[model samples]
Target: MKLDKYTVGKRYGKALFELAIEKHEADSIYQDLLKLREIFHEVPDLGDILSDVRLEPYEKDEIMKQLVSGFEGTIENFLYVVYNYSRMNDLLLMIDEYERRYDEHKSLLLGTALTAVPLTKEQHQLMEEKAAKLLGYEQANLINLIDPDIVGGVIIEANYKVIDGSIHKQLERIQELLLK
Candidate 1:
């Protein structure tokens, strides 16, 4: 029976998650996902090939086997299931969703913080404390990025919300107020 794209992807993710847990290889699977992302980015044609409906299942399976030959055991099985179900096009998304679910299972919240300059160790620790309190989560995986356009201050993004305290935004607001 054929599954829809989302259904296939979700099923693949769930299967991978379970296998990773059973094998105590969640970190390995996550690393494999990152490697696969790089492979997909470097080989644009691979996506086209996977998304092609003209390919036979056996041919597709062969291609997937070659592509994922060196991956960790859990990742190999995950890729097999994805290709068998003709859901290879959703491979990256499914892996990402799986990683997110895994992180949630570990009680870690992912966040992004942007600043005009690199944060000091003290600042980072303070940010973590504040973020933990605000998010009501004991742990966070905070990704920091430098955005000089901000001029100063920082922006914290989590769960689709942006907490902007950037000097660029402040300047724009000031300019707007002055113009009125």
Candidate 2:
């Protein structure tokens, strides 16, 4: 099928996801996307090079080929599609959205957990289990963040939903109530 811009991105992402799953390389693909995101940010001219209409399609393809030479197979194809469609500007967003969809399809929730201190491995595991149970997901990928400003307690964010259990937030709510 001829895919639209969004569908093209979804297709690219789905293809990569399937390949990664089959090869047990999902983590590698995720890391590759992270690296690509960083490279795109660091090299300001790269985007222009990809999107430059002056360059013939073959020339652009060559440039992309060199850029992704060291990437995993799945990511290599992802870059090829991005370059072929001249969607360099949307590359990172497309990959991120695709990953999000892939995670959702696997019954996994990607989220962040903020705490006053770093969590122990046991605590992390417990939190992951609790989050999965509460969110009704089979798995949870919880990114941990340490924020002393939180004073104590934890805050969790999943799928744009925030569960605030932080002392800082509680204090703010109390202060507001007192003022009222």
Candidate 3:
């Protein structure tokens, strides 16, 4: 049966994460995957080539060999297993799921902050500290993004939770109260 990328990611990603934890190599494997993901992002067609039906088996194998050249241990095995099972297209999704698991294991939180203007380094550090405390994580990393519509202040989204402190949101709240 054909599987969606998310499903493929969960199954394969969970198995690989469990293995890495068992071998006490989760950190190394995570680093390898980070680099692999970067490369895949850099060369967008790499994944397509692996999963392309038009490519000869030998040609794909050669490419896979080169791709796995520097990646050893669990990650190397993972690449082969993904290709052997024809799951190359789902590789990035699996890596992302693995990253989520790793972050959970490390007590890290990833989030985004929407603001009208870019945050200064000091503001960023302060926000990170606040997010970590509020979210009860050891560390919280936020990607600061500009949204002129926010009008000012910040809207923090972390682990599906939103802390909307933006001026736009406050104004909307006030307007709702007035309408009521």
Candidate 4:
């Protein structure tokens, strides 16, 4: 059977993650990956350019080197491996899987909190603590999303479950009850 995207990403990510751990640069490598991810987000077409077939391998390599000039050793090698294998399109997935594996190893949970307005640092800390307690994790990596459409309150997503405490959802529930 053909392997899936997730499987391929996980394999590459695991190999890179192990290398990072062995080199005692796990945190640094993760930070580099975060920066790389930011670049991908800022320039959506960068991925397309890297994966373009018309571009020579040396040209693609040069671009990738410039993009990750600050990174060294294992990270550089990992990029070359992905490029040589023509897996540039899976770069984001690899980063995501690498983060997932790293977090798993560190006993951390990733969560998202959506609110009508931005949360203060104190609010973020409190939410992280609450999420950790509820999710039974040592700590949580919380990503805050400001969504005015939520109206008020917060929506917490953790471990594939959604705790919809938003006023918009509450109002919808109440309206459904009234109609019934």
Instruction: Give the top-scoring candidate (TM-score).
Output: 3
What's the ranking of the predictions by TM-score, best on top? 3, 4, 1, 2
Count of clashes, each model: 0, 0, 0, 0
Cα-based RMSD of candidate 2: 4.8
Question: Per-residue lDDT for 47 in model 3?
Answer: 85
lDDT for 130 in candidate 2 is 91
lDDT of each: 0.79, 0.82, 0.92, 0.87
- Clashes by residue pair, model 2: none
Query: Mind giving the per-residue lDDT tens digits that candidate 2 earns over 25-80?
Result: 87778778878878988886786789899989788778787788878476777787
**What TM-score does candidate 1 get on C-alpha atoms?**
0.71
lDDT of 2: 0.82
Those runs of model 4 whose alpha carbons end farther than 4 Å from true positions after fitting are 1-4, 115-124, 144-154, 164-180
Model 4's lDDT to the true fold?
Answer: 0.87
lDDT minimum window of 10 residues, candidate 1:
78-87
- TM-score list, all predictions: 0.71, 0.67, 0.93, 0.72
lDDT comparing candidate 1 with the true structure? 0.79
For all the candidates, what are their Cα RMSDs to the real structure? 3.9, 4.8, 1.4, 3.5
Looking at model 4, report the run of 10 residues with the lowest lDDT sum.
67-76
